[model samples]
Target: MAPQIVGLAFGHFALRMNPILLLGALTGAQTVTAAMAAIQERSGSPVAVLGYTPAYPIANILLTTWGTIVVAVIAS
Candidate 1:
Protein backbone atom coordinates (compact mmCIF):
# COMPACT_ATOMS: atom_id res chain seq x y z
CA MET A 1 0.00 0.00 0.00
CA ALA A 2 2.72 2.45 0.97
CA PRO A 3 4.98 1.54 -1.92
CA GLN A 4 2.02 1.86 -4.28
CA ILE A 5 1.25 5.34 -2.95
CA VAL A 6 4.89 6.25 -3.47
CA GLY A 7 4.89 4.63 -6.89
CA LEU A 8 1.86 6.63 -7.90
CA ALA A 9 3.42 9.81 -6.55
CA PHE A 10 6.46 9.12 -8.67
CA GLY A 11 4.26 8.19 -11.62
CA HIS A 12 1.63 10.97 -11.83
CA PHE A 13 3.65 14.14 -11.45
CA ALA A 14 7.30 13.14 -11.18
CA LEU A 15 8.67 12.54 -14.65
CA ARG A 16 6.65 10.24 -16.94
CA MET A 17 4.33 8.31 -14.67
CA ASN A 18 4.68 4.65 -15.57
CA PRO A 19 3.98 1.99 -12.95
CA ILE A 20 6.92 -0.13 -14.06
CA LEU A 21 9.25 2.84 -14.03
CA LEU A 22 8.00 3.93 -10.65
CA LEU A 23 8.59 0.47 -9.21
CA GLY A 24 12.10 0.48 -10.59
CA ALA A 25 12.72 3.86 -9.05
CA LEU A 26 11.63 2.61 -5.65
CA THR A 27 13.69 -0.54 -5.95
CA GLY A 28 16.83 1.36 -6.92
CA ALA A 29 16.48 3.72 -3.98
CA GLN A 30 16.09 0.80 -1.58
CA THR A 31 19.10 -1.00 -2.98
CA VAL A 32 21.39 1.99 -2.62
CA THR A 33 20.25 2.63 0.92
CA ALA A 34 20.88 -1.03 1.79
CA ALA A 35 24.38 -1.02 0.36
CA MET A 36 25.08 2.16 2.25
CA ALA A 37 23.92 0.50 5.46
CA ALA A 38 26.16 -2.52 4.88
CA ILE A 39 29.17 -0.31 4.30
CA GLN A 40 28.49 1.58 7.48
CA GLU A 41 28.01 -1.64 9.44
CA ARG A 42 31.31 -3.06 8.15
CA SER A 43 33.26 0.02 8.97
CA GLY A 44 31.73 0.36 12.45
CA SER A 45 30.45 3.73 11.43
CA PRO A 46 27.21 5.17 12.76
CA VAL A 47 24.33 4.87 10.30
CA ALA A 48 20.70 5.87 10.38
CA VAL A 49 19.83 2.30 11.37
CA LEU A 50 16.12 2.54 11.99
CA GLY A 51 15.61 4.08 8.58
CA TYR A 52 16.89 0.95 6.80
CA THR A 53 14.78 -1.91 8.16
CA PRO A 54 13.27 -2.42 4.72
CA ALA A 55 16.41 -4.21 3.63
CA TYR A 56 16.50 -6.65 6.56
CA PRO A 57 14.01 -9.03 4.98
CA ILE A 58 16.08 -9.13 1.83
CA ALA A 59 19.26 -9.76 3.85
CA ASN A 60 17.60 -12.49 5.93
CA ILE A 61 16.50 -14.44 2.87
CA LEU A 62 19.98 -14.20 1.40
CA LEU A 63 21.58 -15.48 4.62
CA THR A 64 19.09 -18.32 4.94
CA THR A 65 19.84 -19.53 1.43
CA TRP A 66 23.58 -19.51 1.94
CA GLY A 67 23.58 -21.05 5.45
CA THR A 68 20.60 -23.44 5.57
CA ILE A 69 22.42 -26.42 4.12
CA VAL A 70 25.45 -25.97 6.30
CA VAL A 71 23.33 -25.46 9.41
CA ALA A 72 21.23 -28.55 8.68
CA VAL A 73 24.29 -30.71 8.13
CA ILE A 74 25.86 -29.53 11.36
CA ALA A 75 22.69 -30.11 13.33
CA SER A 76 22.66 -33.72 12.19
Candidate 2:
Protein backbone atom coordinates (compact mmCIF):
# COMPACT_ATOMS: atom_id res chain seq x y z
CA MET A 1 0.00 0.00 0.00
CA ALA A 2 2.78 2.42 0.79
CA PRO A 3 4.61 1.49 -2.36
CA GLN A 4 1.45 1.79 -4.41
CA ILE A 5 0.75 5.24 -3.05
CA VAL A 6 4.33 6.29 -3.58
CA GLY A 7 4.24 4.94 -7.10
CA LEU A 8 1.03 6.77 -7.86
CA ALA A 9 2.40 10.02 -6.48
CA PHE A 10 5.63 9.62 -8.42
CA GLY A 11 3.77 8.72 -11.56
CA HIS A 12 1.50 11.70 -11.25
CA PHE A 13 4.34 14.11 -10.71
CA ALA A 14 6.97 12.74 -13.09
CA LEU A 15 5.48 10.25 -15.52
CA ARG A 16 2.66 12.36 -16.91
CA MET A 17 -0.08 10.09 -15.45
CA ASN A 18 0.59 7.30 -17.90
CA PRO A 19 -1.05 4.10 -16.71
CA ILE A 20 1.62 1.81 -18.07
CA LEU A 21 4.38 3.75 -16.42
CA LEU A 22 2.35 4.08 -13.24
CA LEU A 23 1.86 0.34 -13.10
CA GLY A 24 5.51 -0.20 -13.75
CA ALA A 25 6.37 2.15 -10.90
CA LEU A 26 4.43 0.00 -8.42
CA THR A 27 6.77 -2.97 -8.60
CA GLY A 28 8.63 -3.15 -5.27
CA ALA A 29 10.43 -6.52 -5.65
CA GLN A 30 11.36 -8.66 -2.67
CA THR A 31 9.67 -6.99 0.24
CA VAL A 32 6.40 -6.70 -1.56
CA THR A 33 6.78 -10.21 -2.94
CA ALA A 34 7.29 -11.77 0.47
CA ALA A 35 4.38 -9.86 1.93
CA MET A 36 2.10 -11.00 -0.85
CA ALA A 37 3.22 -14.57 -0.48
CA ALA A 38 2.50 -14.56 3.22
CA ILE A 39 -0.90 -12.95 2.83
CA GLN A 40 -2.13 -14.50 -0.38
CA GLU A 41 -0.02 -17.61 -0.83
CA ARG A 42 1.47 -16.17 -3.99
CA SER A 43 4.14 -13.69 -4.83
CA GLY A 44 2.12 -11.77 -7.38
CA SER A 45 2.21 -12.19 -11.12
CA PRO A 46 5.52 -13.11 -12.68
CA VAL A 47 5.71 -10.01 -14.83
CA ALA A 48 5.20 -7.77 -11.84
CA VAL A 49 7.84 -9.69 -9.92
CA LEU A 50 10.21 -9.52 -12.86
CA GLY A 51 9.72 -5.80 -13.26
CA TYR A 52 11.61 -5.08 -10.05
CA THR A 53 14.36 -7.65 -10.42
CA PRO A 54 16.94 -5.07 -11.46
CA ALA A 55 16.43 -3.11 -8.26
CA TYR A 56 16.22 -6.10 -5.87
CA PRO A 57 19.88 -6.97 -5.42
CA ILE A 58 21.01 -3.36 -5.40
CA ALA A 59 18.55 -2.38 -2.71
CA ASN A 60 19.38 -5.54 -0.75
CA ILE A 61 23.11 -4.79 -0.76
CA LEU A 62 22.64 -1.16 0.18
CA LEU A 63 20.26 -1.92 3.02
CA THR A 64 22.43 -4.74 4.33
CA THR A 65 25.50 -2.51 4.32
CA TRP A 66 23.66 0.34 6.00
CA GLY A 67 22.28 -2.00 8.65
CA THR A 68 25.72 -3.43 9.31
CA ILE A 69 27.22 0.04 9.66
CA VAL A 70 24.49 1.16 12.05
CA VAL A 71 24.89 -1.95 14.20
CA ALA A 72 28.66 -1.63 14.26
CA VAL A 73 28.46 2.02 15.25
CA ILE A 74 26.01 1.29 18.04
CA ALA A 75 28.02 -1.67 19.31
CA SER A 76 31.31 0.18 19.47
Candidate 3:
Protein backbone atom coordinates (compact mmCIF):
# COMPACT_ATOMS: atom_id res chain seq x y z
CA MET A 1 0.00 0.00 0.00
CA ALA A 2 2.84 2.35 0.78
CA PRO A 3 4.45 1.61 -2.55
CA GLN A 4 1.16 2.02 -4.35
CA ILE A 5 0.51 5.36 -2.72
CA VAL A 6 4.06 6.50 -3.41
CA GLY A 7 3.71 5.47 -7.05
CA LEU A 8 0.49 7.38 -7.41
CA ALA A 9 2.06 10.37 -5.67
CA PHE A 10 4.90 10.36 -8.20
CA GLY A 11 2.39 10.07 -11.00
CA HIS A 12 0.61 13.09 -9.59
CA PHE A 13 3.91 14.89 -9.55
CA ALA A 14 4.42 14.03 -13.23
CA LEU A 15 0.99 15.26 -14.26
CA ARG A 16 1.13 18.77 -12.91
CA MET A 17 1.85 21.04 -10.01
CA ASN A 18 -1.47 22.80 -9.99
CA PRO A 19 -2.04 25.63 -7.50
CA ILE A 20 1.44 25.27 -6.19
CA LEU A 21 1.67 27.07 -2.93
CA LEU A 22 3.79 26.31 0.11
CA LEU A 23 6.47 23.66 0.00
CA GLY A 24 6.86 20.49 2.16
CA ALA A 25 3.52 18.86 1.28
CA LEU A 26 5.09 15.88 -0.49
CA THR A 27 7.57 15.17 2.27
CA GLY A 28 4.85 15.53 4.88
CA ALA A 29 2.66 12.94 3.22
CA GLN A 30 5.61 10.58 2.98
CA THR A 31 6.14 10.99 6.69
CA VAL A 32 2.52 10.13 7.32
CA THR A 33 2.90 7.01 5.21
CA ALA A 34 5.91 6.02 7.26
CA ALA A 35 3.94 6.50 10.44
CA MET A 36 1.17 4.28 9.16
CA ALA A 37 3.64 1.56 8.21
CA ALA A 38 5.30 1.83 11.58
CA ILE A 39 2.02 1.48 13.41
CA GLN A 40 1.23 -1.65 11.43
CA GLU A 41 4.64 -3.06 12.24
CA ARG A 42 4.18 -2.29 15.95
CA SER A 43 0.96 -4.28 15.82
CA GLY A 44 2.80 -7.23 14.36
CA SER A 45 0.93 -6.89 11.10
CA PRO A 46 3.36 -5.50 8.61
CA VAL A 47 2.62 -5.17 4.92
CA ALA A 48 6.00 -5.82 3.43
CA VAL A 49 7.25 -5.11 -0.08
CA LEU A 50 6.78 -8.56 -1.52
CA GLY A 51 3.43 -9.83 -0.26
CA TYR A 52 1.33 -9.63 2.90
CA THR A 53 -2.04 -8.70 4.29
CA PRO A 54 -2.66 -5.57 6.30
CA ALA A 55 -4.44 -6.27 9.55
CA TYR A 56 -5.14 -2.90 11.06
CA PRO A 57 -7.71 -1.04 9.04
CA ILE A 58 -8.83 1.43 11.68
CA ALA A 59 -5.33 2.52 12.49
CA ASN A 60 -4.69 3.00 8.80
CA ILE A 61 -7.73 5.18 8.51
CA LEU A 62 -6.45 7.40 11.27
CA LEU A 63 -3.06 7.72 9.59
CA THR A 64 -4.67 8.41 6.25
CA THR A 65 -6.96 10.98 7.74
CA TRP A 66 -3.92 12.59 9.29
CA GLY A 67 -2.25 12.68 5.88
CA THR A 68 -5.33 14.03 4.13
CA ILE A 69 -5.74 16.84 6.62
CA VAL A 70 -2.09 17.75 6.27
CA VAL A 71 -2.36 17.81 2.49
CA ALA A 72 -5.55 19.81 2.58
CA VAL A 73 -4.10 22.40 4.87
CA ILE A 74 -1.04 22.68 2.68
CA ALA A 75 -3.08 22.89 -0.50
CA SER A 76 -5.35 25.52 0.90
Question: What would the TM-scores of all predictions be?
Answer: 0.27, 0.49, 0.27
Q: Report how far off residue 76 is in candidate 2 (Å).
A: 3.8
Per-residue accuracy of model 3 over 3-59 as CA lDDT, tens digit each:
646644664576553211111233233444554554456545443311212223444
- The Cα error of candidate 2 at residue 1, in Å, is 6.6
Tens digits of per-residue lDDT for model 2 on 1-74?
68677767877787676443334334443345554333333433444434445655666787799999999999
| Residue 63 alpha-carbon offset, candidate 3, angstroms | 1.2
Write one digit per residue (lDDT tens) for candidate 1, span 1-76. Answer: 5864776586668767444334434444455555555545664644334323554467567667869988888999
Which residue window of length 10 is worst by lDDT in model 3? 18-27
**For model 3, how many clashes?**
0
Query: What C-alpha lDDT, on a 0 to 100 scale, does residue 24 get in candidate 2?
Result: 35
Query: Which pairs in model 3 have colliding backbones?
Result: none
Candidate 2 whole-model C-alpha lDDT, 0 to 1: 0.54
